[model samples]
Target: MTHLSGGPALPQERRLVTAVPGPKSLELLARKNAAVAAGVGVTLPVFVTRAGGGVLEDVDGNSLIDFGSGIAVASVGNSAEAVVRRATEQLEAFTHTCFMVTPYEGYVEVAERLAELTPGDHPKKSALFNSGAEAVENAVKIARAHTRRTAVVVFDHGYHGRTNLTMALTAKNMPYKQGFGPFAPEVYRVPLAYPFRWKGDAQACAAEAAEAAIDQITKQIGAENVAAVIIEPIAGEGGFIEPAKGFLPRIAEFAKANGIVFVADEIQTGFCRTGQWFACEDEGIVPDLITTAKGIAGGLPLAAVTGRAEIMDAAHSGGLGGTYGGNPVACAAALGSIETMKELDLPARARRIEEIMKPRLAALMDKYDVIGEVRGRGAMIAVELVASGTRDGAKEPDAATAAAVAKACHAAGLVVLTCGTYGNVLRFLPPLVIGEDLLNEGLDIIESAFAGR
Candidate 1:
């Protein structure tokens, strides 16, 4: 019952003292437009001055319910209690000597924790990094070294990261990989068993998609040339698409049989976001390599590639690591975050979030014609909008409706976010520590948005 999040002390209730992007925020937005990079985007155009528990207090004095949790990075909540305490202590003690240069116990402790926490009981090893993209890129490097192969397989609608190699692995184009072309070679794309969009016979989609993906690899690239099969157990930016049952297992089995490393890119779905320490555990899928980042350090920049010791150690001594990799402060924060997760049993809390959110979103689907489907697990739920919501499952995406609804939610002091390759999925990644009342209020705002209230 001890589910606490530490941040600026503020009321948890929603209070719109002014418009979401009120005078102060508007002033800041004006400055940002002039000073910041054009490519950088703003979701609500509000400047957060404080955040904690379930609410974000903007500079405009509006308390917005935080449904996005800074894209799931603050699952333990912004400035989580332990995170602040440990990071403060570490910061005051010593910032960095770089594990590769001077080494530190904090780094080793974080690595050991990763080995203990990540899926599988096998002897595991981990290499820490600064971002999810870095973790993913290194995972590929390790896979290639271990398998001594070049081809890497990823699925359609799978978003790995924004870096060159990762961008190549990512399937979306517009915002992620449009002009950044001439991407890394040797990465192959395959079909995902996305249930909602699967052509026919939903129950058989998993077997069919697995076979299709396997056939493509066997014929297109040849299994011997493949280094790894990387995937998100639940697709993130490309919509929170949870692949059909049996598909993941089949792919993992195929990779194991062919000596292809199976990597679960659990960047967005890890650390209790999906009711488990890692989403792969939902299906009992133990990857050869798993990349984690977003929630690892409770909002700090920390990422890791953890896997079987043999695969993780395949690279030479100096092959892996960065100047900022496993910095003492981030390591300390990660330890604190992990401690908080276990102490609070955030995985169970995430399940509680699912229990509270999914039904409400499903109810919204029932009430709105624009809602195509309500999908996702634990705190990572989403509502896929279509031209017409139907139990039969309409496929036409209604991006306009999604955008309008999200805009309305923001105006009403609810911090909502949208995703999907088609840009028609409204995603919700509430901090696990969010109170039930705030959760309900956020849901009420969603209902109002759809009702045009």
Candidate 2:
């Protein structure tokens, strides 16, 4: 009844002594509202005191089952022994010699490991960064440098980042994109092979989407002008929509044939979150460049743009580095995170998570008319909620119901997250080290929330 994946488990169960956002948390919230910026948002305002091994304890002494994994940044658990040890060692020695100014081994080692673990054996190289958006922007820069083209292509319902260029790349409107206009130019949005929303079967959907995308690139953007075709191997933040089978391969082939760089924005799906070292491996689709962050360094801020040596080196001598890019501490944590992943075979653990969650979610679909579909891969699972009306047509998105379910779970002692362009998808991104008891308890809370709603 114990898990040793993370350092010293903290009684992996839900315990609610006070209300969800007890007195201490409310006190912090009031201070935060006065001190913090209005644009910043929080999913659950419970001030966390400590966390590890599938449980997060708030100041109010409420231990909630962590189903979000800090938005999938804690794949190896929050305080994996290896991560803590390595990071602590690095912190003690030196925290900030910034690799750009004073080069260090940890950053070089991280790049080396990225080359070894990422998809493809094409003499890959990497440049580390401080965040996912920075990695993504650098990827586009590298692609543009290599291809000497100005146009970048992205897909619908995709969430890239919050930077100016990334905001242009993203497809959402309200929170991420709205009021942030005049985005980077020459960025074209294409159709994604969303199986559930497609008009036909899976294969047909893939064919249609691929054809449409190719047509758009050919006529509108012109392949000759396109520097890169970037996409999420398994789209994240866009409802965990797995690209229909055959969709990614066709896009890769088209990019290759047209001398365009194919970039996989695996910030959310990389680092064994999707049952593979990278989600691109699921269909044998090797991207020309891959952007990664999130789970790269346990819970630290680290990211990388890894790709073929030629493409990565295309950037000028000093073109691709930030002052804080690849800090020694973050790099050390990343090395430890990768070591822990390999030692524990976290990819297999993610597969086991899929095995446990998919069936339960599928069963819910049969019982709940609001659950239009359950989709995703490995531990990155989600259920799309819809307003039920007819059986043969499109289901109306029920954002209100999704909000209620998430709020209800929060009221109880479970941490869950909702996503999707329509905001009707409940995504479950549990830490790979979560125990069965806690996992089941989180599911029970979700089921009860739906029932009560």
Candidate 3:
């Protein structure tokens, strides 16, 4: 086994050559414009040549620090040796056999690992998919089949996926759902406990919000008609907002009492992103179903829905699978990724990242008038930008300011990503393997950007 410590050395510091989207990357962008769909949002025009640990080398020959992690997909770091070797070896043997038809050992092994790693000591079962959206959609399907209900409840600022069903489940409406819906029905939205915005005690706010949601469901759709209450423990794209302290526990209690399946969407927060195996583990609340993707296979397209055995068994044998659901190569990559996560103690690494980031971010909050909030769990952190001193800091998000800051950071040879309904929050998902000095350097650049602004 290739140890995580044995990977190629990361660059000591960021270095930029040509402008961010240099000549070669500009040429590629031109080609991409002609060949690819315009709906895709490209943050930086620079094209990647290679990536390892926490740095990305562009085709332009610039070595840039990666704070985006391909939107939290590279938690195990880009091109991890174990993942690469396992994927290559699996590729040499066989690529696909359609696990539902001709099963493979890798597929079964991945499922077994998920069942063990996911939060809960109870009997568990898992099914694989190709993306987070598929995992979430299947969780709903299983919940509905088990509960015999039609309504699914998701919280405000929650992000599930882009599928029709998930679009309805998603909270934001503009980019994800604009012109794309006519969405699937039976989805309900409830308020989430965002302490930074809410005007009450944390526990009280959670209890009130959850009780209100439960009442609304019972009044409007009836609890008997609600199949599941799906949520992201720490909201990801909807501003990386961590739920209020008692919020998750309150929601779990509601789900337990109401017989509604609780689904924890850990796609962006899982695989040790939040210093825990799963974010829900922090509250010690075990959901009936869990959806995961992103870092699961260390950049390969693999997603999973793990849950109690009875709920998973509710779906008929042939009713729950895809042709490429558990592709052999992806499964091999997942096995390697899981092994890497355990052997390297990535969860401990995530805590180290938190230790490094928290104080710096808190300092930014104190210095920058535009920084309304600095929040996250572990490495899945974000800073929400709001215009200074408007309506008790409830000012609308300033996308222009955010764009400028992001561009400035990129010019300084650091890659950062901006996300939020209003495009005003900058999220950081640096690879857990990033060296402390490099991580501090990236944070320093961000501080400089805020200072200059």
The prediction achieving the highest lDDT against the true structure is 1
Q: List the global CA lDDT of all models.
A: 0.92, 0.91, 0.88
Q: Candidate 2, which segments miss by more than 4 Å at Cα?
A: 390-392
The residue-by-residue lDDT of candidate 3 on 301-409, one tens digit each, is 9999999999999998799999999899999999988988998899999999999998999988887778888888788888888887742555667888889899999
Give the number of colliding residue pairs in candidate 1.
1
Q: Per-prediction TM-score, please?
A: 0.98, 0.99, 0.97
Model 2, residue pairs in steric clash: none
Tens digits of lDDT, candidate 2, 1-453: 465476865887789999998999999999999999989999999999888889999999999989999999999988998999999999999999777787999999999999999988889999999889999999999999999999999999998999999999998887998887888998999999999888777669988999999999899988999999999987788899998899999999999999999999999999999999999999998899999999999999999999999999999999999999999999999999999999999899999989888888888888888898988988999999998753236778888999999999999989999999999899999998888888888888999999899
How does candidate 1 score on lDDT? Answer: 0.92
lDDT of 3 at 171: 88
lDDT of 2 at 91: 95
Quick one: ranking by lDDT, best first?
1, 2, 3
User: What count of clashes does model 2 give?
Assistant: 0
Which ranges of candidate 1 are over 4 A from the true structure?
A: 1-3, 389-394
In terms of TM-score, which candidate is stronger, 1 or 3?
Answer: 1
Worst 10 residues of 3 by lDDT: 1-10
- Can you give the lDDT of residue 386 in candidate 1? 84
Candidate 2: Cα lDDT at 316:
96
